[model samples]
Structures are given as C-alpha cells and as structure tokens.
Target: MNKEWFNSRAKINYFDKGYLVICAVLSVIEQQSPLNSTYR
Candidate 1:
C-alpha cells in the first residue's frame, strides 16, 4: 500500500528483466563464436 514499497518492487522487476536480456544476448554471442565457448 505504501508508495515507496511499490517503487522498489518496480525497480526490482526492471532489474530482473535487464539481467535476463543481458544473459540472452551473451548466450547468442557465445553461440556465434567458437572462441567464447572455450571460456565457459
């Protein structure tokens, strides 16, 4: 019910989405390059 709590929740959701997106992009890049796969 509090405005501050709601704002924090929204921020967390945004960060979660951003993190997923980064992971997806990194995976795509790794798949495209054989060198990157060796690091993992």
Candidate 2:
C-alpha cells in the first residue's frame, strides 16, 4: 500500500473505465449511424 503503487493502480482503473465508455459510445453511434451499414 505504497502511495506510488496506489496511484498507478488508480490510473489503470481509470483508463480501463474510460476505454469501456468510449467503446460503448462508439457502438451506440455505430448502431444509429446510417454510414455504418456500409461496413456491415
């Protein structure tokens, strides 16, 4: 439970959550956008 270790872990967790949110938003946009049909 060193301060540096905790900070690194928190950063990793924050990036993971941010990545998931971006993915979800992209998926939602893909589903709604008419341009996505070309990729399918």
Candidate 3:
C-alpha cells in the first residue's frame, strides 16, 4: 500500500529472480563440465 513497501517488494523479487538465474547457469556449467577444471 505504501511506496517503501512496494519498493522493497520489488527489490526482493528482483534478487530472487537473479538468484534463480545464477543457479540455473551454474547447474548448466556443472553438467557440461563435472570436474569444473576447464572453466577455471
């Protein structure tokens, strides 16, 4: 209902989406290289 509340909610949602994306990318990388030696 308030401006501050809406802003915080939007920040939380943005961070949550970013975290999910990072996890998905990490999983894909791991699957591609189980040893994780090539990327490093």
Q: Of the candidates shown, which would achieve the greatest TM-score relative to the real structure? A: 3
Model 3, C-alpha of 5: deviation from truth (Å): 0.5
Ranking of predictions according to TM-score: 3, 1, 2
Q: How many residue pairs clash in each candidate?
A: 0, 0, 0
The 0-to-1 C-alpha lDDT of every candidate, in the order given, reads 0.89, 0.88, 0.88
RMSD (CA, Å), each prediction: 2.5, 2.8, 2.3
Clashing pairs in 2: none
Model 3: runs farther than 4 Å from truth? none
Give one digit per residue, the lDDT tens place, for model 3 in 1-40.
5999999999999999999999998888888865566877
Q: Give a tens-digit lDDT track for model 1, residues 1-40.
A: 6999999999999999999999998888788777577666
TM-score of 1: 0.76
Full ranking by lDDT = 1, 3, 2
C-alpha-based local distance difference test score of model 3: 0.88
- The per-residue C-alpha lDDT of model 2 at residue 7 equals 100
- Tell me which of candidates 1 and 2 scores higher on TM-score: 1
- The C-alpha local distance difference test score for the whole of candidate 2 amounts to 0.88
How do the residues 1-40 of candidate 2 rate in per-residue lDDT, one tens digit apiece? 6999999999999999999999997898798767577556
In model 1, state the lDDT of residue 18: 100
